[model samples]
Target: MNKHNAEYYISKLGLLPHPEGGYYKRTFQSEEQTSDQELSVEFEGKRRLYTSIYFLLGSDDVSHFHRLKSDELWYYHAGSPLTVHVIDEHGVYKEYKLGIDLENGEVPQVLVPKNSIFGSSVKDEDTFSLVGCMVSPGFEFQDFELFTQDELLAKYPQHQDIIMKLAYDLIPV
Candidate 1:
């Protein structure tokens, strides 16, 4: 197989434009569901135990800051490395490089805990990245929240630069 660009993955994988940015296609939803009694009070009904998607980001694309009710695990698939910026529930900020490079501190998989604000971008300007994300307790539209610039800045005043960069709308030309 030959290396391809973001457009290739988007078309081949049948990815759609994602609200938080990037292109993605849900690839899995487990038949098993968490029992209502075992579920968090925030959940109104039973939910699939797990879900997964193929996510792609081009050099110019940015996965805006967003949060989910369930923890999300990211697995690197191909293309260039991606930088995932995260602000934990405690307000601590961190960056994780997602790729196959272990010598340079890149990790093939990373976990973003529930309710942690996060975003991502292709590490190299001319490249793209393809990754897989798995969310436990499944992924429901109701469980997702995209952060607004003002709202996020209010909560994380110290991360203004990055917040502004990732929070702005990316109107495609």
Candidate 2:
């Protein structure tokens, strides 16, 4: 096995299965917080100033379509380039390549705006991508929203291919 393969990082970083797919471990959570009065209706209560995690996605893995109440920034750390698919609030679909290959339009950092339905995948066969994600105003279970195929299809029919590939076939009841 290669020294830096998916399993190698998973074990080294103490990554565990993430609800959104792939593997991850929270790396930071700021002590500073936002009070309930400062947060919007989407937030349940107080939230930390920011939170970060180390995320790993294998070529065969799917991050799945999900949205958060706060913006998320993704930074490429190692391995293959990652493709981040986004369907904005206005229904505009865009893809950002996160990697070090600048000439090919791959960016080292990409941002997913709040409320956008988005997902990520690693395209290189048999390899994986390691990344760091930071969410401002922190991240709470209540702020996370995973999509179902039918629900996303109803709203963004034009993004059928991506939605079908990334959205869950069935949402757990």
Candidate 3:
């Protein structure tokens, strides 16, 4: 186990509380812009080629189910493995474990395709998982959509357990 706790990494990395959950710090934002023609009309204008952030999720916290217009790739960095749950466009539920334990079936990288609703959690108590997420065509607040438990249940009642665990009734500011 890592001797450093969640607080240690938060302080060391200068992470701030993320609206979704846990802590994060934007690490990179590409200066290059993507051609507006390459993206959907909802993009409005050209966006940075890509953006990256360091995301940390603690045992008791969950990254709420949210949708992004762009695809994201998660790379495990430290601590225990984390599980990323996703509901695809077709309403299929899937899970990806991110960690270095290849023998245990944990992958070093997990991809959340565009238009997928996804969230993540660390399963072990007193432990946290750190990862880096890279988003293509960058990430814009206008393209992010957060859902409430009730809202998601209406669309995906079959995922009641996960929705109840990850979706929030009220998001804290």
Candidate 4:
């Protein structure tokens, strides 16, 4: 058997002992100190892992398209009436609404594969959700690109374009 320092072992395995801070308001850890979300890690010393847990304070309204390089998991630990919208590369789109009042404690998990455009919104007053992303080979902050409503309007002056892309009626942010 051989002995290795903590940092050496960690570096060899590309582990992130400490999850990225400020990405979420709170976090949880395992007894071994592994993160509940594993928000970030090192990637062959080339890139940093990117992970996040979204905590909705109370029925937040968010509408922005983010293109992700890695797969992601959405875990609903609490709340109800969660909605997820995904757009594929072929310009196809669909919506998935989850949870009845009884599904609040059921702990449903949804996975979005890599190379998909996605966004979400919470409809219930007490609704909240957490998301986890596992970016193979690591992820970087620059990988995230947000397309906000204003940018959409500027790019597509036609009302039908907005509806086709986002599936909603835009009344100015």
Model 3 accuracy (lDDT, Cα): 0.91
Candidate topping TM-score: 2
The lowest-lDDT stretch of 10 consecutive residues in candidate 1 is 164-173
Model 1 ranges with Cα > 4 A deviation: 169-173
Best by lDDT: 2
For candidate 1, the lDDT comes to 0.90
Pairs of residues clashing in candidate 2:
none
TM-score (C-alpha, index-matched) for candidate 4: 0.52
lDDT scores in order: 0.90, 0.93, 0.91, 0.46
TM-score of 3: 0.94
Residue 167 displacement in candidate 3 (angstroms): 0.7
Better of 1 and 4 by TM-score: 1
* Backbone clash numbers for all candidates listed: 0, 0, 0, 0
Candidate 4 residue spans exceeding 4 A from truth? 1-54, 98-107, 125-127, 130-139, 150-173
Per-residue alpha-carbon lDDT of model 3 for 1-173, expressed as tens digits? Answer: 33568888898889999889999999999998987788764687889989999999999899999999999999999898999999999889999999999999999999999999999999678899999999997988888888899999999999999999889887655
lDDT of 1 by residue, 117-137 (tens): 999989998789999999998
| Superposed model 2: Cα runs more than 4 Å off | none
Candidate 2 structure quality by residue, lDDT tens digits, 55-83: 99999989999999899999999999999
Instruction: Please give the ranking of all candidate structures by TM-score, highest first, separated by commas.
Output: 2, 3, 1, 4
